[model samples]
Target chain A: MNRQNSNKNNDHRDDFPGSFRSNPFHVPDHYFDELPGRIKSRIEQDKSRKRLFYLRPVVQKALLAAAGLALLIGLAIALLHERNDVHVYIGQFNGISAPDIEATLLPSDLDEYTLVSFILETQDFTGMPSGTDITDEEIKSYLLETNNIEPLILHY
Target chain B: MHHSDEEIIPLIQDESTREKGFDRLVKAYQQEVYWLIRRMVIDHDDADDLTQDTFVKVWNNLDRFRGESALFTWIYRIATNEALAHLRKKRISFSFLALEKTSTAAIPEYNDAFYRSDNAMRQFQKALAELPDKQRLIFNMKYYDDLTYEQISEITGTSVGGLKATYHQAVKKIKKKLSLE
Candidate 1:
């Protein structure tokens, strides 16, 4: 039965349509061959509108909404990132443990297998965004932004 | 058939003969785009609307085209995208996403206006149409357009490995679809 099916499958290649499958498959050449002359008139009708290049107010509002959302997200990210970095700097400056921060504010687990765990755990993140209760993350970040790791320069 | 893209681009750059150059472009690519579109929409009037839109956009934006890739690839890209977008707007009756793009396009599945039934090709076209967009495009380019993998990559913005895999899968599926029929 399998052999018969295979033979049957092999037998079906003799058919094609539109002179396309029979002839060479020249798709572009084929399309152009049948394009109507009405297209010229349509192009002429829309030519002036093309030159306008003006966005309608509704389009402008949509673009503004998109831009606003993007900016807000960017600002939030920058703030969150700054806060996280500051917490890290404070941890480093005060001789706080990387392992402790990883346990608390910073997450260190990076495994593909842990994706579901991360997503499920993220549901708990809305209430408690920062794992640590330290406020004004920017100031702390500013103090610890230095490259040089001095001996215990954490200003508490 | 007309002046090459390289020849036409220069003329389009100049304001004087821009219209003439664009007309040549329309003539060159209209038929291929139309058929690809016709297969997708399965409706003549829809195909006609989309083909005109494709050329009109090309005409208006010819000057904006940077010559980083072959003009043919760029034009095919536009045509395929336009057709796909049109299909999406019209809604694809069949879907083959997780597999290849079109589970339907390998065999001849067109109707009486476009294709005849009882032909081996109809089965293949049907299988081709059933494929996902990727598989369909790969099958179309390789089987129909006879394009090289590298050329196809430039046109479809897919990797050569992906195209080859897709073509193999497409042919395999076509065989299966035809067998079932």
Candidate 2:
């Protein structure tokens, strides 16, 4: 063991003339010493890059999802409105009946109903209001008495 | 005392939390973030924009973080996705490949590969840009970020095996294109 140890020591003797060598333990002094401004600048640059790298997908998805949700709601509203408009119809006329018995004659005086039992459909195309709450017998008598002129044609 | 990335994330959850912890997290991880983005984007400005975008996302979604992955991995995922998205929107010219004898003669020479190559990094950037978007994302997460296939699988909703295949294929294509053995 002593002989082996001696040989090992002798072999290592030429490898290092002294225990302290400067080769492995050196760096430029300023390499470890940074000015505050420089360090701060490096830090800012770092933060800037990191911030961008971390937020990319989330920001994009947020904007895209918001736009998508808005479109969906808008489309729904538009579709509902279109559906509502599909079932409607409109008819225009000048008058109602009761004591008046105008029978929905047009404002333009296009025609008059000469028949006693012609239809008087509501504007909604449903049944009429039963001759505006007047009796049919009274309406007929009144029409006969006035020679079929409108009862409310006061000047006549 | 400085907080770890995990500690910093919760501070990013609220607007005020960001006010308190954002600068800290930025200071803490900026070098890793910058080089990662810089290497991927190639251009300094593009890197800058993408880096800022990464943080804003972190700030907004800090609350959603469930501690399932390391903070480093999570942020890396964001960065990779952003870099790929930016690349997708870029309209680099294919004119370099077009012949002068063709009508494309009037076009100028342009290639996405020119700016980024300083080392393997440039090739990595180009390879990343060339890949289909999701594959590029998977590559970035796998190669640079050092994320496991399982973590990437969850983040991207891809199967782990699929991600592995994508990463392997991407590596091969990049190697072939860049003439690496």
Pick by TM-score: which candidate is best? 1
Off by over 4 Å in 2: A1-156, B1-3, B13-18, B66-69, B91-129, B178-181
Q: For residues A1-156, write the lDDT of model 1, one tens digit per residue.
A: 000112232222343344435531224344444564666777887876755546566688999999999999999999999989955754452355544534543343334333323334433433655666655454345434634322222111
Query: Considering summed lDDT, which 10 consecutive residues are worst modelled in model 2 chain B?
Result: B108-117
Query: What tens-digit string does per-residue lDDT give for candidate 1 at B3-119?
Result: 667777777777898888777767766667777666666656677888888887777777888777777777778888888888777676653333244443452333332334445
- lDDT tens digits, residues A78-150, model 2? 9998876643411221232343334433233422244222223332323546657766567656655654353
Q: Write the per-residue lDDT of candidate 2 for residues B19-105, one digit (tens) a residue.
A: 566666666655556556655555555666677677767655767777677676677678777876787688432222233246432
Candidate 1, DockQ to 2 decimals? 0.06
Interface RMSD of each: 12.3, 18.4
Model 2 chain A worst lDDT window (10 residues): A1-10
On lDDT, the candidate that comes out on top is 1
The A-chain TM-scores of all the candidates are 0.29, 0.33
Model 1 chain A poorest 10 in a row by lDDT:
A1-10
Q: What does the lDDT come to for candidate 1?
A: 0.63
